[model samples]
Target: MAEDMSNEHSQDDSGLHAWMLAWYDHAVSVGFIRPPFLLNDVTAERLEGYFRVGLTPVEGAEAFFGVAH
Candidate 1:
């Protein structure tokens, strides 16, 4: 599924999108309301990557429609 979202011409989101989505699913499977995300500004490849994809700003977000920027 990660490969599907990384299409260069359609959307240039970094690999971070895959990692973030994985983290969210994993956290939910583990029954976590708020997962302690490891990726941060220090690790994120680019700040803009956050906005290109559809996801909560915080991984494993407690609520939907969460901030992604």
Candidate 2:
């Protein structure tokens, strides 16, 4: 599923997009009314990957989005 979507975007952007989606889903699941940022879908898959590796939401967000300056 993700591989199919990745075909439509450049490799770099595809990864970023995937992570953004995952973060959005996590935020929503944690009770945020909406995503913290615009995310615009391998979301479940990427989120699952993060969980499989034992990454907490904060860790995953930081790893993907980077720590805000």
Candidate 3:
């Protein structure tokens, strides 16, 4: 049962990761600013915290991962 729960959690995480990547790509394609770094360090919890603060994903990514050039 624990193994099954772990698998489910993994699947959910992968799904969220895929959605976030796709959303970021689309945002950039539409002229949203890209972050200085890759999304590799971003996590679901961090993203959720941004959401709770009322930022759109694009804004959240910029605020959390973007560096001034």
Q: What lDDT does the true structure give each of the candidates?
A: 0.50, 0.60, 0.65
lDDT of 3 by residue, 1-69 (tens): 999999998986776666567557756765654665354444656875665566765676676557777
lDDT value for candidate 1?
0.50
Which is the leading candidate under lDDT?
3
lDDT of 1 at 19: 51
Worst 10 residues of 2 by lDDT: 32-41
**Which 10-residue window of candidate 1 scores lowest in summed lDDT?**
57-66
Taking all chains together, each candidate's TM-score versus the true structure is: 0.31, 0.39, 0.53
Candidate 1: C-alpha RMSD to true structure equals: 11.5
Runs of candidate 2 exceeding 4 Å displacement: 1-9, 33-69
Query: What's the ranking of the predictions by TM-score, best on top?
Result: 3, 2, 1
For candidate 1, what is the TM-score? 0.31
